[model samples]
Target: MSKPRSLSLAAYRVLSWGVRNGTDKPYIPRPEGELIWIHIASQDRQRVVEGFCQRLRQSRPNLSVLLTAPPQADLIRWDASSHPLVNLPSEQTGAAREFLDHWRPDLGLWVGGGLMPNVITRAEERGLPLILIEAEIDIHVARGARWLPDITRYTFDCFQTILATSPETVRHIRRLGVPASKVDTAPPLHVSPNPSPWPEDELIEMTHALSSRPVWLATWVQDKEFISVLSAHRQAMRMLPRLALILHVADMSETEPLHRRLLSMDLRCVNWDDGGTIEDTTQVILTSDPENLGLWYRLSPVAFMSSSLERGSGGRDPLTATALGSAVIHGPFVHRHQQLYDQLNRAGAARLVRTATELGDAVVELLAPDEAARMALAGWEIVSEGAPQTDHLIEIVQDSLDQRGQDHAST
Candidate 1:
């Protein structure tokens, strides 16, 4: 009812542009079966959706599903082109409502980890057996919600099932008055999309064609972390003559500035956007798309989750790298993804550093075949632990839907 906030406006414009110019996404086709709608609104939402889909597809591969997320890509990215996903418009009322009205999914799954109030209320009115998965509640966000306490309470109440990432969050929401019966505390899902079509032949060819030397990925790099990455690159090249670096920024627009930085490093740089490659002597490849990181992750043996070099970044996610069978290295500042990093590191799946020098050293050390293999195996095991959670989610959803059918029969 009020004017859209700046974040809402920006997200609206991006989603609007994408939906307008975007080719029509084929509506998920299923008749006479239950439908699922997953609303994602946070940076980690993609992982949740992927995990949900992965689990649902396993026992019931033909189940119809729709995945939607916010348009803030640098923070969270959801590309529907290759999967059963749709980019939900962010204005929060008109487009979101229209999407729901059309599908009228039998069961609605809202990972409102970052949802706006209007979107939450709209789904609530439909009484579609809503499940709020991995809901988050922290002090900073609670303070913001204080300005609209009633709306926040109402949103939490909308869910028939409220699954949270931790006991603390579950307690926080209960303090806000959501019934305890509606809540479940569990570890959030951590699934990353596997690169499809193998890309194996091309991947191997890309590796060999790019460099026979050791390659390390500086993934999801942003402005705050670029200078340090460049400096590390220059310093790293001096000792490891055959080492190659891949700089994949969070935003593509950062590519030009990254190239300029490369010029001063005295290293031959290749730009993926410019259709470039690593020559026999090439030192770095600047890739500027977040989507392509999946491919690069599969290609590289060791990767440094970028954005961790800066103080406020909290950190780039290590789960993605772990899921792809690469040894993950992150800075000590991964607070946003603290739980995931903790799980992986505790499982011997990842390593952490406090500075660029330390990160550089770790990168070189992790490239060793024996060390890399050991880390890779651990990383895979960590990711595999998520399968059980995924299984539990599907069982719960199916049982709830079945119970609803039984209630109707009794009535």
Candidate 2:
């Protein structure tokens, strides 16, 4: 190691110690249940880790997860009420030892990157079962792995199982002296379906009330696309007089304005955020609370996912509605989730509409029972295609934990 690099590492250790013991102590007391610690090094890997953690928690109610990432990494966006988030300590031996001593995690899951060789080696030395997922060898080179090739090899050897994301990564891990049998290429973990939080009775009541009515939903509609959605709804209403539209605004403050706009246009609108009821004459149900999306997705057989119609507005995830049995119709700006949208489009589960007229036509076509059923079934299949992989990962984690328990009991 060069003198400057060694000094930089020493400074990092001192900073880590100060952060831990200073006024902003990031440590949270470990919960009573079996705890699993996940170390995430890059912001790009946070989404996959969050999804895996969500599925793990759902599968094993008794298990708790502790997430640790570098201070600069953008962690998971969703509310992490159950899982506690903390900053990973510096890779210095003392800082790593201090972190492990405080949390005492039963199992450690390191995602993407071998940048923290010292911390990883320290955990393995302490008899912790460490698994590496989505391992990237480029991170090793970027962190100057060539400077201490032997140390890099030793660190890679710590992981009991290494799941590489590509063939190149697999070869890279093999070059680092990891056993060939221990490293295997695996696909990136996909996001699992997270059902919206809505009451069952409310869904039932809304379904019963909207029985036999032509209905569609515009979910997470941004302000810029309001006119387009309204125009599509108006066009659809002309073809089917009893057409009902659910306009779920992305911004809560826009709910009142949207309701006023509908009323000004002589459309019978119901404001859901203000305890307004959907009567027989109601043409549009305006709501800003996204929590009630489950109800709308269930009641409406066809839905248009928003944020996609306008330029520069990257699309929102459509799986949430698809998982709830809604056939999705999206706009042209879905580059953010292009792969997923492409899969759905190719599977005949979703339709892409670039104009308001196209949106209306798609809505009208999917309103038919047979058309809606076919699309919904296809969407459901696309959403469920990754179930086997998710289940397999969960089984591996559970089995590892079980074996650890058995070993402890035997001792």
Candidate 2 error regions (>4 Å): 1-33, 40-45, 68-103, 139-145, 165-176, 184-187, 194-202, 311-313, 332-339, 346-348, 405-411
Candidate 1, residues 144-229: lDDT per residue as tens digits? Answer: 23343355566677778888988888898998888999997888775643434446777778877755588888887878887677
Steric overlap count per candidate: 0, 0
Name the candidate that leads on TM-score: 2
The true-versus-predicted C-alpha distance at residue 151 of model 1, in Å, is 22
lDDT of each: 0.70, 0.79
Query: How well is each residue in 112-167 modelled by candidate 2, as lDDT tens digits?
Result: 87457557765777778888888887333223334543556666777888887799
Best by lDDT: 2
